[model samples]
Target: MTIRYDLPLWRPPSEGSSLIIQSTIGCSYNHCSFCSMYTNKVFRIRPLEHIFSDIDAGARDWPQAHRVFLADGDAMSLQTESLHRILDYLHARLPRLARVSSYATPDNINRKSVKALASLKARKLSLIYLGIESGHIEILKRIAKGASPRGIARAIQRASEAGFQVSCMVILGLGGREYSERHIAATVELVNAAPPTYLSTLQLDLHRAAAPGFVPRWERHGRPFQSLNDDECLGEMARLVAGVAPARPIIFRSNHASNALSLGGILPRDKEAILRTIAQARNAADSWLRPRSLRGY
Candidate 1:
């Protein structure tokens, strides 16, 4: 039996190896200005029977699949009971099922109580990927992120307390050149306040062709978007590395295809090394950065 995935399925870079089951058709909140991921499809939860069919097919083919990432966009936005049913079925079919993860937003986490989260964690749905694009309120509003920095921190901490592995993502140069300082400073503050288990960075590359409204939405605030060049982007990354003082160790990465330079290590431990590399990249950009033609969103 073949599983039919909707066109343009998206998963976190880390979930590249997992069995992907489409719990939903598109993003529940498709209003973010910078995202064109789900603009083609309207949001709707897949029927339970349809989802179960894909699960059974996946198990039949990959009987020992240990991890599954529910797609598309925010599967965590589904109701608590709905998630429980899916998790129950997944364990029933895949004896080696060790983890279940999905993309999530602050609103999704906030809507679920600690008890609900703990219950889900018990069922092995224990990881969540969040896009805290920028912590600066002005930048957030300008990008139509719909969540505040403090609120994001609360959601991250809440999930952590309930025994979930939280992966947070920050978009480098999201505020472009104008708000670079504010963006990096606020992001550092948020991460320090509520550090996630994994922290990653993806440089901003507005898919104007995919998102026809990106420019209009971004220009809504009457500010001209001045995107940071390769060196400038590296500088923002350096400032972020220098400013972060997490309460605990955090796994950091900047190897997304969009990043100019790839870097990964545990924070506070490899902080200096990462910063020095960023400095080197800034100084010796031609050698350090990926060729401009090699990068993708």
Candidate 2:
């Protein structure tokens, strides 16, 4: 192999076919209660020379590649100046490179100036995968997400203003059973106010590694977290699809492995059909939903 990736690397499902480059190691803010994706490593930016070597190798392997996904966690944590240099190197190495994307934390996006973001966008860092997680302020704190509803919305809006497409993910059962209704309501309001170009849903499936901290953190809110059943998870997803009436259309997806159902369509456009499928899945045994044993995060 021309390029060797750090083990346990991850990227959005859509980026599976793109060349993978480790621009950073782990997440900058590793305190999110419901996440274990980066618990195994400390966060740090890759040296520019190492990143350049990876790009050069990738070009030799797949010169015609048009898209690349920066990994291992939020590559956006790199300084604006560092990112500009990385983007410049990527294009110079891969003549066909058309887009470069990475997971981004809301804080990181908000930290950079709009002019910096716009410059990055112009250089083909055209999209970011943001995990809004949940838009409810209480949930945000309980999870130690390091971001509030307002802050996440501001990040999304700022990215749009910079002409960058944002792909945001919201967890389906972040609030569990007790706060399900409130979670969905708050999330709906936030998305309607600051819509993203794409939105994806992830059902709550706490990893054994993440569950230790995830449960305790939420209980600190004065209530024990109760896991949601498949039926309830579907209900929350249905409400999200039904309520996502954005001024501009949002491309919605629930294809994450954790979700019981895999759905895709444009909100406020294919809303009815999306809801109808969920409605029909009232029976857990319905062929419409993935079986319990098959579900994963």
| Model 1 regions lying over 4 Å from their true place | 207-210
Error of 1 at 278 (Å): 1.1
Model 1 scores a C-alpha lDDT of 0.90
Q: How far is each candidate from the true structure, as Cα RMSD in Å?
A: 1.3, 1.7
- Per-residue lDDT tens digits of candidate 1, residues 78-153? 9999999999999999999999999999999999999999999999999999998888998888878889998899
Candidate 2 per-residue lDDT over residues 110-161, each given as its tens digit: 9998999999999999999998888899888888899999999999999999
Whole-model Cα lDDT of every candidate shown, in order: 0.90, 0.89
